[model samples]
Target: VERMESISRVNSSDHVAACQRSNVIISLIDEKLKYRDSRAKDFSAKCQGLKFLPFVTKPAGFSLNWKGNYFKMATMFSAAELYTVEHQDVVCLLKPILNENSPSFKGCGSISLAVKDFLGLIRKPTINLVLNQLKEVANYCEDITLYQENITNACYKFLLEAMTQNEANKVMITAELKDCSFILVENTYVDAAKVAFHLNFEAAPYIYPLPNKYKNNFRELFESVGVKRTFAVEDFAKVLESIRQDSESKQLTENNFQLCRRIISEGIWG
Candidate 1:
């Protein structure tokens, strides 16, 4: 009977906690919806005349480049930093005691309870959930690219079949003269059209006649498949600006040297 009563009490407490968690999540969602609605007008204005792909979705996570390395939003915060009481000092203080028999400790609640609550908060569907959504969007982009490539190849094969045997013979005699001409014209038109349509498009002024050694060096430097072939001066400036901003935000400056010293000192003493 005692065991049954204990189990029942435990179940009831769990049900209450679940209800509380549900309420908190619902409240957060409500606030998010209200904020979203308030920004709807501004968002719509910014999206004017933009024909967004119907299948592509916005990534939920913010992108960050740290020390010349790109990292996902969730991974930016270190595990130790995430559990540190400095970030959620109040929550650490208010967390319910996990066991009455535990020894007292400085800084926050019992170490085990603090760790548990920290992990729980991290696991919750907060802003980090947006990162998962972004990964899905990236996958969708890859799928679309593959589909487009297949369509392009199919169209090329269909056009190849349209030529007669006599025309094919003529093309072979002139080293595929008709095929070469068609390809050249199509490429020129597409390149011109792309430049006209896209403001960011900038064609290379001249194809560099690189020596074999130089070509090999270039290939060795940039062997990644998906890396962009070229970058504009403006793009380089933007990257520099991003690095400056990130450094400034992190206070990695002479003025913050003392702060770092203090942190190091604390670690040593602890």
Candidate 2:
């Protein structure tokens, strides 16, 4: 019984030591994991194009003999190349570094503008591909939703404008400026009439007398003329709120779906 008791005590001591070692290992691993996660987050935040750095550096170079024009050209060319590849990661990275306050960001606006013009050259089919790629990058970055939205809107607008212009200038131009189309009246009819009377009695075209009551009604009349009416501020706010809610719901559904898929794949559902 004495020998048995001694052996049991030794075994218990070994178990305790093993547990302590296991805990130490786990703590070390947790620390390493946390450091890795922090580094990853930091990296994602700053991942912009590498080419802009040299141009920014040149102005501040020890020689102090840098040509701004050459720097601008180089940066513009780099931006054009990046834009062609639809490298939004580079663009996002470039934004903060090129800000007005940043020493290196001086020529950034020019580079950015060049990139924007380059993006204008992208065809419709390629625009969607670039947008999806940007979305994936934005999702991974997580905090760039505003940037993503801007990029998406810019791409969409560019495409819309390009398509509209192309259609308008087509060889078989079927586009018509239909009657009742909204026209911008610079001044009130009375003001226009007075100006006309001052300039030439008969040279001015007949100006319709706009009533004071009809000033507010002009917007309604404009709409009646086939001009697409935009939502009022309040209505637009509600529309945006609805869209936000829908997006949140969709994201939740996607997360749930992913979780279920993972569980099934691991045989946890069985």
- The global C-alpha lDDT for each of the candidates, from Candidate 1 onward, is 0.27, 0.30
Per-prediction TM-score to the true structure, in the order listed = 0.14, 0.21
Write down the RMSD of all candidates, one decimal each. Answer: 26.3, 28.2
User: Per the 3 Å backbone cut-off, how many clashing residue pairs does candidate 1 have?
Assistant: 0
Q: What are the runs in model 1 whose C-alpha is more than 4 Å off?
A: 1-144, 164-270
Instruction: Give me the displacement of residue 232 in model 2, in angstroms.
Output: 28
The regions of model 2 sitting more than 4 angstroms off are 1-144, 167-270
lDDT for 174 (candidate 1) = 32
Please, what are the lDDT tens digits per residue for candidate 1 over residues 87-131?
221121112111111112111122233223322322322222222
- Candidate 2 lDDT over 134-253, as tens digits, reads 333333322334344444334333333333555432211112212311122222112221121111111112222233333343333322223332222343234334445656856545
Q: Worst 10-residue stretch by lDDT in candidate 2?
A: 195-204
The TM-score leader among the candidates is 2
Winner by lDDT? 2
